[model samples]
Target: MAGVELLTGRAGASASALALETAATRHPGALTRIALIGNPNSGKTSLFNQLTGLNQKVGNFPGVTVDRKTGVSQLTPQLRAEIIDLPGTYSLYPKSLDEKVITDLLYDRGSAQYPDFVVITADASNLRRNLLLFTQLADLGLPAVLALNMMDVAEQHGVHIDIAALQQELGVPIIPMNARKGIGIAALKIVMAQMLGAPTVHFYEPEDELLPMIRQIRYYFNLHNDYLALHYAHQYRHIGFLSPDDRAYIQELTEKYGFEPTARQAQETIDRYTLINHILLNAVEVTRTERNEPYSNRLDRVLTHKVWGYLIFFAVLFLLFQAVFAWASYPMELIDEGVAWINSLIQTNFNGPLVSLLTEGVLAGLGGVLIFIPQIALLFAFIAVLEETGYMARVTFMMDRIMRKFGLNGKSVVPLISGVACAVPAIMSARTIENWKDRIITIFVTPLMSCSARIPVYTVLIGLVVPDVPVLGIFNLRGVALMGLYLLGFFAAILSAWAMKFLLKTTERSYFIMEFPVYRWPRWKNVGLTIVEKVKTFVFQAGKVILAISILLWVLATYGPPGKQEGAEQQVRTERQRLEQAQPAATHTPTENTFADETERLVASAKLENSYAGMFGHVLEPVIRPLGFDWKIGIALITSFAAREVFVGTISTIYSVGQDATQQTVQQKLSAERDEQGNPFFTPARAMSLLVFYVFAMQCMSTLAATYRETKGWKWPLLQLIYMTGLAYVSSLLVYQAMV
Candidate 1:
């Protein structure tokens, strides 16, 4: 076979080659292809970061378990290269979709691009299990290098291996280094350069003593059935080879081979393990005793215990929710003030309708959406710390028993926890659960978790009603009340899942299988990157919708029904004339300034009352009247359907009319407002009712759309909408009645 060579390096390399006296020299850009493959938790990502730094993009594969991460790195001053980070997997048999990604890119015949070389990253502490994947990759006949990651950890554990011997046996170059500390990176780079310049090495099945045994097994299987040996051989030789087509083929082969295939698989697993064990024993040595650490396991003993585990979990959740409200308040206030200042500046700098639209509509709307970034960042930061500490897995394990009781999988905890950040990613994360029933149930209930979108609404309502009072000695009662709302969402999800269990019947049995990686110090770099990416995505995605809605709302408020503005001016002029006629001549005719002020007031009121949004509010008034909502409040509710955070901005814009004129805060504006009956509209009763409404409302369109896509039908999304909306309505009604 003719071999085609590709180069890997950083961005911005030349795309030309030079002919030397005895050889051809390719320019730097020709070397831009690097493939990253590794076992799960082997620090492959850290290496990818070191190589690519800030030059990477994340996207999903065409239709697979893999997230395609591509980046550029400068290998040499003259060469730029592209790097691909493949999904983490154990072996390459493709038991799951994530693993299939690596295998497909490597050997699939239909693939258009193939890596020039493969970088196999192995965990130093667990070399035995890690080496198994490397050996398999080597067998595929690709030019490969071994990256011995976490060398520091391996030394701390007193484990040692002769690098030269291991590299000789594997027929590859080995570089030992700590990816987290950036050690041995230079050596690894040099080795990569040498390997890329050298001739390609072809690896094939070794002719060993086991070959006879393999042949004998094949012969025995062939005698029993025609395609049995062929099928097993095909599976063993292919790296990333599982798909629906492969499954169907296996099913057909299974039926033909009968009972022998099952027996043969068990035998094959045992054979692989035995061979791997022997190799590890001969090639590696452990000089130190295993540490009897009690911190992690002892903590898990109580945290994952059958009973106390749940109590601790709930306590942690309560604290997290309370922190989301209490801790975020200071930053939120700063952001609100900053936005108001920007708006004031914009108004002063420009004039006309376009300026008004830009200031009150687009800028206000964008600011409203952007204000939630601090809260999202804080929430995700806390979650990252928990995950980095390795406690998240224990949470899943502990919740499994109780979750199973509610007909939800333990794995559902991932999505549910993530839902607090944003339902979009939380819904997507449900894909990690392999069981169809469990995945569907998790997706259906995930949005019920109070997402950050609801934070502004909750904050406004809670501030208005739940008075600040010390409770249980130190904790704030208002904080406790906020926690209760989040807990309510959690319980609601569990109850719904229990009902779903009885409603949807399936024969598939649930299985709980997860890895418990060794605890390590939190990598701040990774945590920072996660926070940045999540915040960026949220801001851009939500900003688009809020900006559009704000523009539409501004137009509706500015241009009322025909003749409405003229009618307001005429009414104001008539009122001034009447007042002048009744007063003494010494009072002097009412000033033009007074007339202009009266006209402005009348115009503002008329625009709001007759605007399209006002019409919508009037239409829904009867339905929401019982829930203690006025026409203005009703309009805010409708716009907030796009996102709960928009509620604050909607209320701000609506209540900004004819005010003390310069005050900007929503709370300040709301406090000064009064109804036609001369009572404050944001009464405690109404605030409590709105709070309850937001707690249970299904108002996020992105969530609804994601649900539809995941379930591949409208059945679940429709059910979610009906169920959540009904719950919100009933709950708000109850709260209003009790409070009143």
Candidate 2:
């Protein structure tokens, strides 16, 4: 009611008066906070997307790693609301971190993120199951509106609900919606502007046995609602907002009353469902209509078939990789040429150390990061489509049995698949796996799944070694090579998981229970948004690291200890003069220019070999030389410990220094490199060896930090770093030796 009045010029109020009132009432034109809560797959997020459009941003909730998506929605011309998409959960009683996040915020009224009003999205087709959480939230006495989503799906299933009757019976506003089609959004917004008061109805009353304890919790905590007090009793220890003194008092009271929270919570659920069943009787109608096997079920027969399922899944990945290589080529080339042109422009116009820093250090490093955007965007696009279509769930279902054999829960498949995007969140996602050992094992092996961060490294290396010719007149050889690297990472992960099965022991059993959402066309808007978000994250985040490292690297490579660089240049000049004098005039006439250019190149190379970076690389060379890496490559390996993708940026900056006027791409520079013996560096054997090394290496410090946070100790992350590094070293050595 207040929101409505603020939006319209009321009581003959002038426009200026309304503007003044708005500014004074809100937090200096702050957005009203509205939270969207629902069971999983209830079309909650779809509705959020519809409301927020391009205004959405993602962040973590306070101290937790679970993604918090918030956006601004204009509910009216004068009123904007900040929409918070809370994680989906079945009930308020927390089972996982995601579920805990929901209860934590809802129970903590003092928290800034606490919603002014809640929009509960319920599946019209599965009203009874969906309303269980709705009833729980209602008892918390929050002012809320219900969005009855999936009306079309309900109609197709021959289920009809009387919205007016349901609203009246439940004592809340109910708006019928097909969120995918953008229906009822306007109506929902209208109701939200005129939000209702907190519900007066008690959906579930605590029994007398528990009332005294609930009363005590309510009195001590200053909670206005009995359900909030009961939740504290059920989940006191896990509550984030509660202090040590609060928890201690609650624990003592629990002992005093001989209360069993779990049993009481179960009884509460049964009571709520019974109440929901009674309330739905008059408002719901089901028609018994004859129908063929449902479309989703019919398709799942083949998609989830024992043998065909595995083949289909692999074929999808194969096609995805093929597309990544085939479609991204043009954009990648454009980006590469663009960077070179800019580099050339800067070099030609400017003549100072500052110019050199911009051209060689900043531009080269950022260029490496930018060139891979097309490929990264494409990879994220494919992943988004798969998830949006609901087929990713089937992949999880099909992999359960296979995963169990490798000492993983079926849920482990999510993190492994997620790792294909990035390992940081993939490791965090392992919290969904309840069993301690299963979660730890998933965390251990996830980084081995080649993430998008490795794409630039993989693409550059694969192009150097693998031909672009088509395989079987369909698949590109380069594409297949890229896919092979990914598969190599995957198999390595599972095998490592199998070995760790014996090393870390646990008797606790694990179960993977998941729902299969109905297959639907991918939401192109959501897909596009995902692509933009992922690419932006890659460019900006990687750009920062690359730029810093590149500048530092340039400084190290450009100068050496006092007189060493100048002495090397002088020595090259002396050698060139001797060669020119010893040669015959007629023989030198045609090759004179070539001889001078070669002499200049030698001076540059000699100076680089004497620089600080080169010195350090030389120190590391003997350790890595058996694997076919030169000191330059050694430098990349050491610097890339910060991040795998930095290897490309490091190579870019390293190769750009003291170069000829001809601007070459990073790959071209690498290809033109020669070893001391006049043999080509990065031969197929060496390139493949580097590829295999990155496939197993724990090259990301952020991933290590994430693992440390998730596992709550340094022991696992340190072990992870050591084992992964060892695996990378041994595997690369073996590959290089066998091929060479």
Candidate 3:
């Protein structure tokens, strides 16, 4: 088996392998195109990851926004293949946008995505249900192979499969596999590199009433498979590859012959299932007649109990939030030290505007964002583990009831949860919701779920106001504060949705039906990959905005109207001299060293207050005063519109412009600030107020753009902006006034 280089024990397999080898020799540079298709959650993606590893990229298909993942797999030392992971669908009949992508690409031979061969992954335990999709693709006359995935799960259930018998019956090769553990990978690659046989047994043939219509379509399109021709007749309107004239021709013929597409499609499915069942009856057998309940089922009794389920879910969330803060603290400190070291080194060894731009502007701003990577990565890792272990599906199932009360469904939970990583993609995920009203409402509220971008802001502010003391002998108070802010956002989102339920009218209703996948240990490789990709997106995307704004903010804070800065500095000096003169010469005063330090601090503050950034902040200060925000905070509020995470960078660059970079971190700089009354500037009331504002504010322009993309208009986005801003302002005002 280790030396299985060619597919044997099947008729014509040797010749197929020979032909494949010859073709490879003739065109060594060309990649053999293969597609992987299966039902949703059938281990299709796991097999894909095994086959492709890190050699993958994601993009959109030709004309649609649905993700297209393609990767190169080396079948042999010399044979390489390009693998396209198509969206999972139950069958050929399309119901949603994702399923339609498969139908369109399969029906159109000219599509760039059309594969030279297909590897249909099926769940070994649920072969009866998974085979329906495999049989449909076989009937399309494409060269195909069936990879029986999840063999471990099947074996655990006391199910036994006769691989040879099933392959003989279906007239195609079947490889038993557990994709997660990389079992049977060598055999799969061996068979994949060989020429494959199309199914000799066609599972579905057109009935007499539909044969004429299908035949006409087959002849007009010069197609070889009857099932494919039938697909065009049934799905011409939705198929993107067909021309207007082609669709019209099919439409005209359908009406002329009175072809019933709905009836014919339903019958075709029924007929195929009948064939599949008879084939499996002799090919598959159960090893156990009486056995204890499976582990997953036993666990579900407690894990999915209505009352216990919710509690367990929240408990998991609590631990996750706590871990994010506790586990990431060391790495975050290291990053902080590294950034400060680099800034100090640059400042000591260099001098000029460009050096200032690099250290004060670029380093200060980007360093603020980089220090939080540990926390962000930890958060993403937790999420990835939840998804990998199949617990996320249970969460969705548990939330369906709650979601409906607020004009949403269980499907809305996915986007809202995804918003924890990013609102842009989370809003895009709303496409899975079919009902127009449900999707719109989901998009409207997804941004309110505190995303990873806000973690930097939240952690900093929470650390300022909330002590890091142990709670209940384990929990960190800061972590508790982080959880409270997230829960607050969640509550705000649902409450807003409930209010909108009656404000907007729609007759369309939506329902959610989902499957619970058996729990498995989290795949650490997949988890690692997810963290890498998410961190990259966060750094590259947010870093760009932070760098540009950091430079701009430094300019605004470092220099003002030529005469104004000088005048402000002179005024500070003049006041100091007047104070000295008023003091008795004999009165004890500060030593020369202490006096110089105080004078420098006073002069820096005076100049900054009159700089361009300060002038602009002063304008916004009056409006934000009710919320306990001062001029510097007002500047941050305005600059953060570009992105919420920029608030930290803006603060860093502003504080570092005229200060010693080596002496203090952003938190220390802020902690040492004072107001006119000589009170700590970032008091608990003001810190909490700012946190509340950010939790509700529509500060990310990317989210607004994503909303427009999802809703296809400014109508909803504009309303979202206005209502969210108003909500943030009012909420911040209330929190500040009450706390003060």
Candidate 4:
């Protein structure tokens, strides 16, 4: 306790002084490292954004794909700080992947993220439950601040805390602020700046009975403190860095000492709660004020109703789809025009295969991907609004009962919701579902959700069949079609989950516990950032795959086996000449009967059909033909396995190269395409068939790889790929045959 000294006994100043002392003693860098910790719904993300603005990015913690958001915050003019927003957790005891990341980072002295200071955020309205995490972090004795977020909601509840008394009892600066309103931020920064060079202090300790065992662990690990050693003692077996030898020794010592970590954790929680309740007796006051039950609770009555709730959700989804079609039309058209212009410009400048590569491969690929941006942006924007308003939690609550019927736990809703963004992260999020069977089932079916990756594919194909006409005088029928595709996916996921549920069995009980926050107006700033971040991630991440595949496809389409292209133009000209001459002189004029442009396109097609990728496509054509796919589409199917988003780019590259240099867009080129018999290649039946095919196909390798990592075996991902592919083939076949 040498580094700790109260600035004023039972007063407010000691909290600031302690932080300052801790920083002075231990602040080791020019940029003070601050770690943000909080419970779910405490507005930690909002606070992080307020602190760092757009200067933040999401990255993976070392060796784990769990997202770690880090950013730089200028706490004050004098203090520069780096902030890491740790995932929310209730305690140091790990239950999920995210929780494990926190426990591992905080307890490991060797970690770069083992912070010099911590900012523990809590919801003022749910102070009792939120404080459980705050008290646990305080025990680590790092220089820390307690931010009572959402003060407005607390005021509405007639809840008040004596900030001075809480500061004295908790021995941390108590900053009561509404993160959404930016209230108290300046004062919090000023206090944080003052504590930039403070020393760390021990504010909480274990019982005398456990101190002996903690000391032994500290000595054995050569650790700096008892808190770190105690964590190691409890979780040695699960600790990634601990050797088998280390785990064996810890196991032996714990058994010999008759130490029970679970029992110890239970006792600690009770003792801490007792201490906390006593402190609150002096530090907090509650009126038990009578007010209308929270709006969230009232709204949940209608929103979570068994029948009406579902109808409302579908209505919302239909509205979302209609917006995608309505709002995105103008922008999508502009994108198509821009791409056509670029393709025309590039095609005019270059010659031979090089011209095709630039115009057809690169520019066309770019055009296909960019056209979907508006639709993607709109989709995520609506989702963001839903999330910010807390409607999504209600969706989760309603869906939980349905999930239980499918062998999934309530927590599966998180992964399924996340899957809409991207399946890779969604599968990673599934780690939070503790039951092995439930987590595996969630992972298997998450990709079936209509991810943003599928937006381009769906919009492109759906437009071929579903017109943009308004339905019921207000809604876009095309949007209804899009929603139908999504519903198809959802139902497919449910059925898949049911099948897997019957196949995989576990002995552990399933449970779902969650707290819902009172509804608030959407934070527009956060909503904009959410959409921007999601769209940016999509463009850049998908761009890499598209670019690589486009280049490879260009090479495959441009080059052929020796002499393959030789006489191809001559052969096309010979056929056109014979046909033109055979027609009566009175039948047509020279220009009218000419097929020069068509002949050039035919030659290009013939050469491509014999080229490397085309030859491979021909090999796949027979396999995929029953699903209404030709050789060109077969090539796209093969490349789409790398990423489902690549389908548009693949089609763009394939069609653009074989097409005449007529400055047409990819969609126009596709629409104008014909079968060998001169019928439209993409009839409504074929379009619907392909759309159904993509909806069920497990086309992304990354999702499969993520599943492998999550399940620690290939069995699940392999089964997933097979099941989805089979479903896709059979569904597409039936649709195409019935429609034809």
RMSD of each: 7.6, 6.0, 5.9, 6.0
Kindly report which residue pairs in candidate 2 clash with one another: none
* Clashing pairs in model 3, backbone N/Cα/C closer than 3 A: none
Write down the worst ten-residue block by lDDT for model 1: 12-21
In candidate 1, position 549 carries an lDDT of 64
Cα lDDT tens digits, model 2, 1-740, are 22123223443145334433543354444667889999988999789989998888877888765668899998879768899999888888766667788988999886777777799999998899999988888888887788999988888777889876787788776888888889889888876765633334557778888889989999998999888998898889988878999999999999999989778877878888888899989999988546655678888999999999889988986677667667877898899799999999989988798998888778877776676677767766777788789897798789888898998977787678767866765675575565567888999999999987799999999888888898999999899889989999999999999999888865544556678888889889888877776666555554565556667777887878999999988987997799789978887877777677667667776787789877989998999999988787887887676568779977865664434425457788788777678677879999999999999999576677568766656799899999999999999999999999
Local distance difference test, candidate 3: 0.79
For 247-310, candidate 4 gives per-residue lDDT tens digits of 8877887777788999988987887788778878887888773466766778889988989998
Q: Where's the lowest-lDDT run of ten residues in candidate 2? A: 1-10
Global lDDT scores for all candidate models: 0.69, 0.80, 0.79, 0.75
Poorly placed runs, candidate 2 (over 4 Å): 1-29, 196-200, 407-488, 499-511, 622-633, 639-695, 698-723, 730-740
TM-score of each: 0.74, 0.82, 0.79, 0.81
Q: Residue-wise lDDT of candidate 3 within 373-465, one digit each (tens)?
A: 776687668777877898877887888798989988767876786577667656765755655677788999888989877988998888877
Which parts of model 3 are misplaced by more than 4 Å? 1-30, 196-201, 215-224, 240-259, 407-488, 498-511, 540-632, 639-692, 699-723, 730-740
